[model samples]
Target: MTDSPVLRLDGVAFTYAGGAGVSGLDVSIAPGEAVALIGPNGAGKSTLLKGVLGLVPQTAGHMSFADADAAAAQRPVHAPDGMVGFLPQSAELDADFPINLEQVVMQGRYRSLGLFRWPGRADRAAVRDAIETVGLGALVKRRFGELSGGQRQRGLLARALASEPRLLLLDEPFNGLDQANRDALIDTIRRLKQRGVSVLVSTHDLELARLVCDTVVLVNGTQLASGPVDEVLTLGNVQECFEGVEVEIDEHTLVVPGHEGH
Candidate 1:
C-alpha cells in the first residue's frame, strides 16, 4: 500500500429525512486493501455506501477520492466515471429483461464512452476481460434473465468490473448466494486486491469479512469501531453491535446465530 490513501472519509455523515442515517464515519482505504463494513439490516451500511456514491445527502464532514485524476477536480461525493465501481445490493433491472449478459456488461462502459461515442476495440476488450474475470465468459451470449441467481450476481459484478475502477464498493453481495457462489465472490475479491484495486464491502458475515478484509468498520446508525479486523472483531465489539446475539469464535471458526442469516 502507498502512503496516500485511495479513498478517505474523515468524520463523514449522511442524513436522510426525518433524522435517519449514519454519522461519525472516519476511514481510509489504501490501494489494494480491502475493508469490510459489518452491521445488521438498517444499520446504515447501505446508506454509507450510497453516500459514497453521492446518492444520499452528506450532512457533515468531508470525503475525497485520489484515483487517476490527480487534480481531483470532481467533488468527493460526485464520483467520476471509471474512478469507482459500485455493485448495489439490489439492481433495478427487470428479471425478464431482453438484454444479454454481454450487453449488460457493456452498459458500464457507457459513462467513459460518453455521448455519441461508440465503443471501440478497447471497450470490447474490457467487456470481455470483465466477463472472464467474474468467471462468466461462457454465459456472455446467454440471456441475462435465463441465468440462475448466482450467475446473475456474478454477471452484475462483471458489469461493475468493466469500468476498471480504482475503488470497488459491494453492498451485501454475499447475501442469498449459495456456498459455491459465495466462494467464487471471495476469490474474485482476493484477485482484485492482488491487482491493487481497493474494495469496500458491507456484509454481516464475519467469516467472509475475516477472510477477505484487511480492516473492518462496525456501525449502527453511528460509528462503533474501526481498525484492523483481528483487533476490532472481538467478542465485546460483536456483542455491542448485535444486541442479545450469541457469538462464538476460535482459531478456525466463527459462529453467530442470527447474524449467519445474512
Candidate 2:
C-alpha cells in the first residue's frame, strides 16, 4: 500500500462456502484509469467487486482503498470527501415510488451530510452536476419508474456521479440496454474518463471493454491475464480465460471478437 493505490486488491480470496470462491487475486488500479474485470458468468466477477466494496466477508487476502484496508474503511476510514461510488448490476426501484429523479440522485450525497440533515447548497449543486454529467438533466424531473431501461441506467449512473467519488465501480451497467442507451452510456463513460475519474467496471461486454478500458483484468476466479488491453485481450488469452472458448481477432475492430476458452 505504498502511498495508497487508488484501488488495490492484494491477494484477495473470498468464498461462498458451498462451491463459489475466488482465490489468489492481486490487482492494482491507479488514478484516472479505466479498468474492466471481465470473466465468464459465475467466475467470481461480482464477488470481486463485493470484496473491494467490503460487502463480502473474506476468508483470506486483503482489499484496500487509499492504503486503508476494506474492513477498516467500512468502519472508520472515511477518506477525503467524495471518495468512492458504486452502482450495482441492477437497482430495482418502485415504479410508482413517487419520487422524482432529482430526489433519487440526491441520495448519493446524503451519507456525507449524515441522517436527517438537509442538503446544503453545495450538496444540491453536486446533484445537479451529476445529472448533467450523465446527460440526464432533461430527464431528472421524470419519475424513476417511468424511465426506459437505458434512461434508468443513466439516472442510476447520475446517482453514482453525484457522490464525486475518486473511483466509480459499475456492475453490468450495459446489460439489457437498447442500442440507443448503450451508445449514450458509452459517450458518458468517455466523458467521465476525460474528467480523470477512475473506473472499475464488471461486465461481459467485450466491445465496451475495448472501446474505453485502459487495462483489462480477465478472471476465472483466477487471473487469466491482465495489463494493456491489446496484450490481454489477445486470442490466446481469451481462449485460456473463457469457457470452452474459440475466438477470432477481428482485424477491423482490433479486438478478439470470438472465444474458445475451456
lDDT of 2: 0.79
Steric clashes per prediction: 0, 10
- Return the clash pairs for model 1, or none: none
Taking all chains together, each candidate's TM-score versus the true structure is 0.89, 0.86
Q: Which residue pairs in candidate 2 collide?
A: 243-261, 244-261, 244-262, 245-259, 245-260, 245-261, 246-259, 246-260, 247-258, 247-259
On residues 1-262, what C-alpha lDDT tens digit does candidate 2 reach at each position? Answer: 1335787766667677675877778788887788988887878888877766656656666566775664542342234457888899978777689988999999888878898789999999999999998888898789888888788888889888888988898998988989798888888888887887889999877788889889999998877788998888876777567646432233233333444342
Q: How big is the RMSD of model 1? A: 4.3
Model 1, residue 60: distance off in Å is 1.1
Measured with C-alpha atoms, the lDDT of residue 94 in candidate 2 is: 72
Residue-wise C-alpha lDDT for candidate 1, range 147-209, written one tens digit per residue: 989989999999999999989999999889998888889999999999999999998788887
Q: Which runs of model 1 end up more than 4 angstroms from their true locations?
A: 1-3, 67-77, 245-262
Best by the lDDT measure: 1
lDDT scores for all predictions? 0.86, 0.79
